[model samples]
Target: MPASRCGAIRRADASENIWCMTEPSAWRRARAFSRGPESTGHRLTRRRRARMRRLAWVLLAGAALPLHAQNPVEVDAQHYRLEYEDKQVRVLRFRLAPGEKSPQHEHAARITVVVSGSRLRIEDTDGAIYEMTIYSGHAERQPATRHTVENVGSTVYEELTTEFKDAASQPPKLVVKAPPPPPPPPKKEEPKKAEAKKKEEKPKEEKPSVAASAPTTPGAQPAGTKPAATGTTTPTPAQAPAAKVQPEVAAAAPPPEPQPIIKPLKVRPPEEPNRRRRKSFAAEEMSEATVNNTRLAFMEQGKGQTVVFVHGAMGDYRTWQLQIPEFAKRFRVVAYSRRYHYPNPSTGKEEDYTYEANVRDLAEFLKALNAGPVHLVGHGYGAAVATLLAERHPEMVRSLVVSEPGFDKLLDEKRAYRSHWARDEIYNIIRKPLSRQNPENGVRVYHNWLAETQPWQQIDPQEQYERMQNANALRAQTVDPTAPAFNCEAAKKIKTPTLVVAGQNRSPNSAEITGTLAACLANSERVTISEAGPAAYLDNAKEYNDAVLSFLGKH
Candidate 1:
């Protein structure tokens, strides 16, 4: 709690308060009215009243002095735990009542002021003493001390303590008086040593019945022995909490192979019109074959070799919003939103969202439209889809440029991988529902994960939060399907030229995985995009676009 003096002035109205002084110095006249010459019947001179008032001011100032002069904290009077000295020292104050023994304890250096009463018995390993009539206002100082206190007083006792150093503030040569050093710690007696001592002390006093008595050493009593009345011997920890006999439980036969426990797949109903309006941006002239039964909205205008840009998960063609104009000038660019996204509705089932299904869909769309051997560029989750497509249909992929595909190489089947997979799997399952249940708490967890991952940190706060929401929502819609459906193994079999670019700010897992993917491919290159994150294409658009253009031209 802040000191009362540090608080702002009260806004309370003072009109009804006759004793209220408008300012700190107004106590003078108020005091004069209360005290005046007993014989003076008429109104006194203003100067005389002022003189009397001045005296009142002096007294009031004295009474208020303590509030401003010293910082005193009233720690609990019962348990001595306290914080004082402006967070410098922790003070603990306790009082032992009559016939009461304080628990064996220790103090780090302290000074005590005796308030009243005595017959205080302070005990140590050496001996104990009873001090009589320890007067009030007496201060006792102890340094590096350990002892137990007992109060023999009939009435309540009190004490005030102020702690200070055990040594004086001067050089050893100039120092005069200092408390004697505390006694050394007692040597420890090992259990073996104690057992040897016991054997020596009771050489021939042994008896066969001693085993029965042995269990009950000093205070322990066996059956038929009188029960102790005071300070009962607590049974040895092993003897206490006696184990009770429990009825035998027969082991049940193993469950009958769980009956295969196949869960019926829950078919998702067709999405609403609003949900189906998928949007895609294309920067090339579209052929008639491209306008098929698919709910794909595309805008195209450009020239040169066809370059189709695939956006990632929970993303529309808008991801290439910045690249369309630049790439259209050189390459025939086409950006298309995936099914089930805005402006276009998907006719296919939930399987369409799977990596294979997505890649297949893009391949079919490209083939139908006669978009052959087109250079492909994708970002983040989209990069994963692009990799699968390139792997599966190597002939169709002229060259591939994927930026920051989130694949973990270290996350193979192992303790570390299993733990991460479990966490991510649980996160995938519960994130959406949990976030919807409590947004603030959900965002907190998201940001905590974000703080650990560089890609997340590179994103703006608003974007990061939105990404979390979108990811959670996407997870909600597409329940747990499968783990890593992308054919990384097929990547090695791919004969198409490949370019894998990763952001430096992101965890190296992406680049490392990409490196592995590139090594698997017949012709592949691994590159790093500096000052970029997971969405490197967007974070550093021009640099990334140029890199892609250059890679494709060379390939």
Candidate 2:
């Protein structure tokens, strides 16, 4: 409720009895004029005043009514369900059963994470109708608006929508204006003629006494009085010049009465039940922090040579869940979601999601951790990031281990994936789906694209969750404007010992890519593990860990 409205209500309630007490009762009506009958004009005048009082109350009540009366979830519980809410954001799980429709409801500015995609028609607040397809694991930022949804598709439309509630980032609401203060006291007239006459006579009468009170000696007056030469005391009316005496009179006058200090009664906003729970949930999950002013979600454990885990495409910090535990037993491990992945909010603009942005985030992430010269372990797209980090900032890396690295910069397009079936299959799996904003399908393609890799079930549940969380990141990974270039010659110059691991069950195409990369690095060694496919770390954990541990031991 607005402050103005609340006060209006309070004022109305306080004055409700005042009208009855101050106004005459109808029972106190006077006798009819001429003791015959009351004039119709007089009766009408009384009735009009009574009607006006009732109308004032009606107007006051209408003003106190809320601006927004409909609570979206409460009004349309079937379609809109509160997930988690807080002062900062409100998380809602919105869905419609197949063929189901929803009534109009309002939503604030929000970010929507689609769990299931479908074709749907919606009527916006302005009464415009539009049809759009929502894809699973796809994310979008929406401004505040009202709308109704109909699940035109056979399947349900599921979304995890988070709305900001704090004026949606707008300025704070204006406080209500208070009632006017009472009128100030009236001014008083100056002194009368009698007082004025006395003021003139005082100068003449006091001059002699003032002089008599002073010492006869030229140098000093009485001990109780200040000497003329000292000038510390205010001069008397009789001895001082007329102009000086005027200043004395002004100074001697008493101060005016102070106006009472009126401080507004501070009204503390009531705690929202939903928001209270939301904050509790946030406390349990990953605590949010920032890097380069960009918010990041991460977890850290252990206390040795920092082993920073960088994830690949369609992946996040959770991808390293298995590695972190095992490695943290012997070394410090840091796992973090790259920008726009999982809990890490998106920068939103498509142009912001680029390889350069990823690298810059990675650099700042490491700097924020402040664990100097870390041992780098990265998988898939993460492996590519590790490669870039090592190349550009070699001093920050003590040793490097990259699994199934995705550096196509070293590829001779015609002889490599370009003319080959690998490129075509890869495109069919990821690219085509991304064209339609369907990263869910792309995620399946990525995990199962290489048959030689471990079975999908072999991946840890937490890693799977991370992958699903960042399914939307797949498109951005494919569309990065600043794709990295692999330099075989530069790799040869690196003094940092590097271990490149590949899946023993990987296809010939996978082997060729890794083999070429390892050959480029003079101090690097290539290891092929038979335990898993392209993703040796997850598909073949035991062998992969041994390989990494052994290599880390040497370097």
| TM-score versus the correct structure, for each prediction | 0.43, 0.45
- For model 1, residues 52-108, the per-residue Cα lDDT tens digits are 889999988765432211112232234353535532334444554444566444454
Report clashes for each candidate as comma-separated counts: 19, 4
lDDT measured at residue 202 in model 2 versus the true structure, 0 to 100:
65
True-structure Cα RMSD, model 1: 33.5
lDDT of 2 by residue, 300-408 (tens): 6677778888887666665665576678788887777777675454322234666667777778777767778889888877788888788888988999998877566
For each candidate in the order shown, give its overall lDDT on alpha carbons: 0.49, 0.59
Residue pairs with backbone atoms closer than 3 Å in model 2 (clashes): 312-381, 312-382, 452-533, 453-533
Highest-scoring model, TM-score: 2
RMSD of 2: 33.5
